[model samples]
Target: MQAHFDAQQRQRSKLTELGLGLSIDIVAALATSAVVAPFVAIIDRSIISNASGRMPLMAGLQDGFRTLATRPAVLARQPSVVAVFSVYAITYITANASETIALSANADPLLPKFLASSTVNIAACVYKDKLLTHWCSLGPARPFPMASYGLFGLRDSLTVAASFSLPPLLSTMLQSNTSMSKTSCDSISQLALPCMVQFISTPIHLLGLDIYNNPSATAVRRAQVVRRDFIPSTLARMGRILPAFGFGGLVNNKTRTTLKRWIL
Candidate 1:
């Protein structure tokens, strides 16, 4: 029995290991989605409410701005929770679908993700943006500039899409898969590696968001731009991302290990 167990362990190949690794990433992504998005939403609503009241338009716009702000983000002043959640959800689906297509075609996932995120973001913006209400009951009617949404979605969705994207672009050089070992992939220490990558890259992600918000006549650039608070602003974002990534990793690792242990 001891020899058989050892033999079975050795039989696991790197390709199999990669598959397992990808599965963990998916679970972690979903877990982060479920936890972080809601957690940030609550905090976001509170912050936006304190400043602009419970108005959805103001909040969504603020949320959208923050979704694409630079590190030491400028969007903190106009914070909106709904916009953040909307972006997060849309990017999550886009990333998943694009990744599948990339794998099927044996191409780098980044290109597909970039394209899909850039496009679908527009759709998500139109539907998810609560600010533009055609119904007279909400407020004064206004023309929706689909251009701004596309630009905002491009930056926001791209950064978000990059978060889960495994292509290891020049931008994601900071991300390291060194944490996951074939033998200990499910360990807490291993799980923490991906979260650490996410933590390190958080600022980079925000900075990418900041780019499209400026330097153009697009609606995104037209919105009120605030000064980034540096340390405090970054800490606020870290608080949102770190907990979600860490908790998601922990939950998935534990659940998977428990089930496997039981079965074996």
Candidate 2:
């Protein structure tokens, strides 16, 4: 009778944990999205504008907010703006919810965190990129190529690893070597890795955008676009990535942790 009672208690505990976790995820997602979405939305527009050859990098950066300051109503109507907030909310909810489940199951949370964040980020980003590419086009919408998704997936996966998986490991190493607090280490690792990973992911991102934007262009022309855009696009991407993954990830995780401690 005692053993059976203990088993029942354990099952009840798991259910309670799950409920609490989902509540925390909702709160964290909202909190992070409220803070991060505006910056991400602007930087995202800049990257896409620069990639699509709509404008030069510096001009694109300025133009993102220029529309907002000058024409708030028009900026409010843009689909990409809505997509940015939605993606951030969805990503944080999935990331923390999966981690919560892994904890309840007595499993390593890192793998679930990595998998959930990576899959959701890649899908959300590819769809957003496709939408923005068409939005920026002077011509009518063309069919999106499958190859674009494949390339974007590869790039986003590397970024997901840098954002979710590698940060904890990097923080651990940093903490071991230095006397900084865990928060400091976590912040540094979160910010630094995403910026560094852009070097590798930027070219792939530009190539994927080129292919999607001008699917009929020759290989030589595609290569030339990639080469020409490489430096500015890479720099623009690094700026965008810092807000999206670096500060965003850190803020989301910290909010989840703080909320869990306070309420759960």
Candidate 3:
């Protein structure tokens, strides 16, 4: 009778977890969208150009605000919500401020984008990945090298959200009938909002890129640019991200084992 009762409880737990995870995502997105709409709405190129300078900082500010608004999802993982949010909020705003300032100054557009990738990566890997990893979950033990950070921001920016989103998904697939380790489950649950937002924002990011860099370009031209660029670029990014995230389960297992052995 005890065994039978336990089985019923396990079944209910799975259902509850799945339901709660979905709810968290919906709430986080709804909250974040309101925060994002305002910044992205106004605050285009400052008329003074170089006088105002580095205007893309607002994009970074947008990124920071968006990340902060999504804090509800990360509540379980972050040790101190205020500290983590403040760090990432500052990092993102600072980096993007530089990008926008450079753009307004008519500096080469590519340079700011390239340089900002490194810092953005640190924000994602450290703030997003490291901070959120529980006391003994399978997050990487040390900082990835500078080059790796570059690759992370430059190439995998969108997919980090995807990557972070997948482990629990994999966990769910593997043992949907049973409860998962709390640490593992919570981490994945937290990622749901970020993953959905990243995938959904693919087009928006691309559109912003077209308009911001080529200010003189007409709306039709920007639309044409978006059409011409979106497919090939997005596919290329997903192509890189899919394989990496797809292998996430194996990577998690190995890392967890390594950490366990070290602790012993």
Candidate 4:
């Protein structure tokens, strides 16, 4: 009787695991579609519009200049907006790449894992290079914005948290072939809940930045003209952070073990 009960419990656990996997697959598909659909529509419209022989390469130049000239003064004063957006962009790219690396590591197709890791490394290198270039270009006359630095720190925290979570979730999911482990199942559930919180926080962050900074024509022109200094600064920041990340990995034997196992 006990053996039968155990078998039944295992069967129920497997069913639950299959259901959860399906749900995750569905959500991932929808999330990707939601992001891609608008991009596709915009690209399609651009292609269709440019297909006409009458399309002038500089047709929008006058309008663009005019829009820039008329931009609000508040935006010019609020450097925090640019800083916040830059930080968010950096964090998002890093977090997503890290997540992809973790998830793809244990995938059945070796190609996916290789591609994901390659892409992430390339992106990180590029961003770090950009950050370094930007920092070097900024002369002594132009001081670093304190508010921007603060915002960047906050964004980094978010990125680190997200990056840390991905490994555990991926490891948990890949642990059991039959998916009967309650701990593994619960990890995925917990991982998903934070993403929902991130979704909610994003709009609030955007709105807050918008309220403080309204885009103006002059600000737009200034942005276009200003040599990006963020790139070099970002690279330097990464140099400091990467060592710490490596140290943490070394200290956490379980994480290191999981990473190595998945990599192989």
Residue 3 local lDDT, model 3:
100
For model 4, how does the per-residue alpha-carbon lDDT over 25-119 read when each residue is reduced to its tens digit?
33333333233222222221221122221222133233323433575344323332233223323333343344444454454423443344334
TM-scores of all candidate predictions against the true structure: 0.43, 0.91, 0.32, 0.25
For candidate 4, what's the RMSD? 18.3
User: Candidate 2: worst 10 consecutive residues by lDDT?
Assistant: 34-43
Candidate 1 structure quality by residue, lDDT tens digits, 172-203: 33234554444343334333443445434433
lDDT of 2 by residue, 1-264 (tens): 999999999999879878988998888887887666666777777777777767666886687778878986676567777888788788888888888888888999999899998899889978887887788755678888899889989998999899889999999999999999998999999999999998999889888888877878999999999899888877777877787888888888888888889887
Each model's total of backbone clashes: 1, 0, 9, 13
Pick the winner on lDDT between candidates 1 and 4: 1
Shift in Å, residue 24, candidate 1: 11
In the predicted model 3, the residue pairs found to clash are: 53-101, 54-100, 54-101, 54-102, 55-100, 55-101, 56-100, 57-96, 57-97
What are the lDDT figures for the candidates, one per model? 0.44, 0.84, 0.41, 0.35
Which residue pairs collide in model 1, if any?
68-209
For lDDT, the strongest prediction is 2
The residue-by-residue lDDT of candidate 3 on 63-152, one tens digit each, is 434654676354323343433334333433433344445544568634464356345544644444323222212323443234333433
